[model samples]
Target: MRNVSSPYLLEQLMSRLVAPDAPRLYTNGQPWRDARGRGAPRHAVETEFKAEHAVVDLSTQPPKPLVVKCLVRELRIRFYAVSTIKNYRSAWVCFLRWYRGPLDQIDQEDIREYLELLVAGGASASEVSVTLSALRTGLDKFCLLRCTVGLVSPRKSKQLPVVMSKKEVQRMMEAARTLRDKLLLTVLYATGLRVAEVARLQWSDFDFDRQQIRVQLGKGKKDRYVMLADDLLPLMRQLWRHTKGVGYLFPSEGRRVDRHLSPRTIQRAVKQARILSGIGKAVTPHSFRHSFATHLIESGTDIRFIQKLLGHTNLETTSLYTKVARMKATAVASPLDRLRDEPGSSSESSGRQPKPRPSVGRMRLEVDPNPDSNGAYAVTLGVWKDGQLLPLPGMRATMPRQDWVSLQIPLQDIWEPTLRCLPTAQRERLESPEFFSQLQREVAKRILRIRDAEPFQALKT
Candidate 1:
């Protein structure tokens, strides 16, 4: 292979991926190449650019790049991230299973049919997009084929991110069992680092003097600095002293001290925190990143600044926070508010009181078949009526438990959940009030939802 001029910043690709899994967690399961190491960095490892099909060696046994081994070699030659290579390999395997045609010979229609097959098999838009992106990139870079050029991906429905309120964040932190867990949750929301980034964080990355954390080689393999929370610095230091972690900030659990914590572990911790905090917002690790950006926007930070802090190459990506953010748009005064009094404010209309919950010996939850803006199904369990369960069609039971109850809540605050809702909603901190009252109501609804799920419907029997 000859030294070639490529469009990519080849130098930036150095200091990473030369050694195999040296710092697995930090470098997406690959090690950074030490410049001080004896060998030359693997940058200029590709064949010379071809003119009139002269670059690629068509004379080989497998005719080069057509074989999986050759394709993987090409990926390493270009210094692609380990995660990228793994994902691309999976996508390639899937594509090969679907279509047996030659890689360089597949036409636009073949690509379209494969995409349709993926859609028909119930692959989500994001999943389909990843597969298509992998094919486009792998084929173009390795085989120099561009079969998916005119292919249009399935349009995705953009759901607003689940953003936890500041109070909810406080409660989440309070819910963490150990100091390390608390620090993990705090760093996530404070710095807006991805869960993976937090998992792979090193002590050297923190610059207490500058109050910034250098996020080296993040999502797009781009390094950028993010603000280190002043309030969190004390707790961070305390945990640092407690754990004595050096290479990776949050080391793995159960005696694998050499490796950093897995992203799944952090996710589980965040989920546990959400449960303890009594929040039922399907909170994931990414929720903290979304909340960080949204809260910053709500606090009136410039969009461009948020973009740089997030290490987003595109401003439009950072601008996504604006949709979920409650800022000037939410503060816009409604013209109806100008009239303090209604056109005809009378005692009959103005002083109408809400009907109180019906007094009953035993009130139970019933699933409502209605769909609303909040979610697909709702449990109508607001207030009872006339010795029977009254369905509040318009109301949804979404407000998380506001008070701190006993650590052992059963028989006092919340009811023991049934087996049906155990798998999915076990994390759900069911509401409080009475014996088998609000808490049972939420559990019953989750049970119904679990039964409604296609995969779990068999369990309904």
Candidate 2:
């Protein structure tokens, strides 16, 4: 034994001193010779050596790439919402693919180019803004670089919401193919609830006694209460009974009874109903909410109240409906109508005297049947002039008066064509005691006839 003193030295000497006929071993524990009885080539041996090293290196490395996983982990640790995480992850993935460089080394110019590319690819301003917001959030949360140069967001457009008429809403509800759809649309309109809110509704949300619906985790993650229509309560109760008492008010169809109905399903139902109803407008579920606010404004509901019902953070958002309310548009007295004198006017010589115009208007007070909260009916002085009926300014008051009943209103409040058309001297004469006495006697006769008329006698006490 030449160097057998140490076991390590003995093993090394044995590996070099083994006979050529003895089984020769390769790194993979295989015989060095091939089936043809020749040693493997140098290139083959080198390839096997490199592959073995690669396998060892990979086994010691992470299971998957760390960049995106790290990003998601950071976001989760920060308690970002699931939807927000998904959006941010999608945005970052797209950006990383487009950049084709290390994320840590990306600069503002790269971001600008990517944003411009998105716009060129037909992304809307809102979509681009969301992407930019995601990228900014990621950069702030993950990277140390505080640089945000040249990453300008596109300006959002100010677009008014589309609204449907009350009649159209009624027609759409009538056209609903299923009772569930009708109830969905009706509840949306009646409560001004968002589509998501309606979909997420639970039986516990309804308060039959209070006539209110509680919305939990509404937009901005806030909770609020909206009025429930008395007319809708019976239908809601029937629905609750039909669905077996408790759970999501509109549960997902089939065995997934725990999940609420999806917003997309509600939206599709509304869209199909709109198409069948033939309203010809771009009717959507959100259009119902818009119609609710506009109709309320038209009915003289306060803007602040509408704002609260709609869960708007600012009153200005609710005031936009004032510009679109149907009553406001129809009730506006055109300035052009005030400027016109008469239907026909003839060009005459300067010497020709103008004919005196007749007092072509009549003023009378009419009672409103519907009393206000104070039990005072509205009194309106309607002026019928030239085939047109218009309310005289400063002539509207609230009082307890019957329909068709007349009262002797003061002539001082009468101003339109009657007093305005008179000459200054004649107007002063009409204000004198003698003219006043004559006017009072004539007005008393008109009041007597009005009180004795069949329509006035038929009015409610």
Candidate 3:
């Protein structure tokens, strides 16, 4: 094989061979290198820019003049949290790289293409929606354009949240191998705090006298108060004393002792405890929040109160706990129980069998005009018991036509329950082989008599 020297010839050959939708190749090969030499690869440059400017660490704030400085400035002016600013900036950088065009020149089609690529790359619906939001913020505020990017996001799935049983929570707590792990899990379940809220806690947030803990900059950048569990107070005090009332309730062990612990650290600890406890559930730090809400609902607390405790803006959100709560539904009596007389009733203790009331009824053996191809008749049993005249319970049986002669045997067997209240000796005698033979003969004779009846003969025709 001869090596190709001309970049333009190699580019033409590669374009003809590679599918248009195939992932762009990255290599030092002549074709790819030649393409790159035409201009800097926008995605590679943008990725490097994002790495330098996107501050993902909660503890460390990035320097000024961020990649999307205008967006950051606007978000800050509107009082957006540091986290939201980082996300929007990251999204804008991603869009810039994917579009590979000047920001002012990009239009709605470019936006749709970027979103489609995100969906194709397996980004979740919420993630795509958030990215769209970031792009809108930039275009509307910075670019001064009001174009509608007509991309419909994937429908959100209505998945039930994962919750842990009380016993499972206890097992996870017990499985914690260290004091920090135990305290972390306890705080999460006790307060239903988001992992980020817990990671941001400081000693000043606790109020011993009021028995409350303040959570600042929650999901919506709103502050809320959660009841401090009395049981957890001692542990909190011990942790505080051990750490000498440090900057954060849980401080990072690294040299940056002034900053709080990262939420990822606590998440990893919770996962380890869940695995050690042998729980097969898909447990995450947020599962503790779900368990907190569900346990409160189970304990008879009002849903409104639970909503406040969990900082849910909507009652519908809190009401989802009702479905999973260990509530009155668990103690409800099944309808099947109504069929039996209650224990300690006069009839149960009387020791006398209730007299069988005389009733008039008829049993019809229905034969399907066209028997199943297998030559089997579908048989159904409808009975009106002595006390109740309604046909509430029905039974079905299938048998081959050749076995019809033995059908009376199973029918008589089905009626054995009517003699259950009789003395055991009497019942045993009724079920005896000799008694069964006589009963079978009587049933067979009755069935033959019915078969010869005018109505049955007419139906057979």
Candidate No. with top lDDT: 2
Judged by lDDT against the true structure, how good is candidate 2? 0.70
Q: Write the per-residue lDDT of candidate 2 for residues 269-384, one digit (tens) a residue.
A: 88877755667788888999999999998888988889989999998889888877775546676776654444453333234576774332355655555445864434554546
lDDT tens readout by residue for model 1, 1-461? 64636534354355354586545333354544545666755567766645244223323434333565556667778888988789878887778777765544767788788888988999999889888887777665545555777766668998888998999989788776556777898999998999888998998899989999999889878899999889887887766664674778888776887799999988888887777567889999999999999999998889899999888899988888999887565569676665546566464467767766433333455554454575434544333334544332323333232211121122321323232223333223223234234343344335434433634446576
**CA lDDT scores, all candidates in order:** 0.68, 0.70, 0.69
Residue-by-residue lDDT tens digits, candidate 3, 1-461: 86888997787678679888765555444334444566666655431222223222212333223536756777788887787788898897777666544444567888787888988999998998888888777665444454445556568887888999899999888766456778999999999999999998998898889999999878876788999999997887767656887578999868898888899999888987776677899999999999999989888889999888888888998888898876475588676655356777665677678666332343233433333575433344333444543321122323333113233235454556654444565456555765544333333334433433545568699
Which candidate, 1 or 2, would have the higher lDDT against the true structure?
2
Query: Stretches of candidate 1 above 4 Å error?
Result: 1-66, 101-104, 328-331, 334-340, 343-461
Give stretches of model 2 more than 4 Å off: 1-65, 327-331, 334-461
Off by over 4 Å in 3: 1-67, 149-153, 329-461
Candidate 1 vs candidate 2: which has greater TM-score?
1
Q: What is the lDDT of residue 198 in candidate 2?
A: 93
TM-score of each: 0.62, 0.58, 0.56
Higher-lDDT candidate of 2 and 3: 2
For candidate 3, give the lDDT of residue 219.
Answer: 80
How many pairs of residues collide in each model?
A: 0, 0, 0
Scanning candidate 2 in windows of ten residues, the lowest lDDT window is 47-56
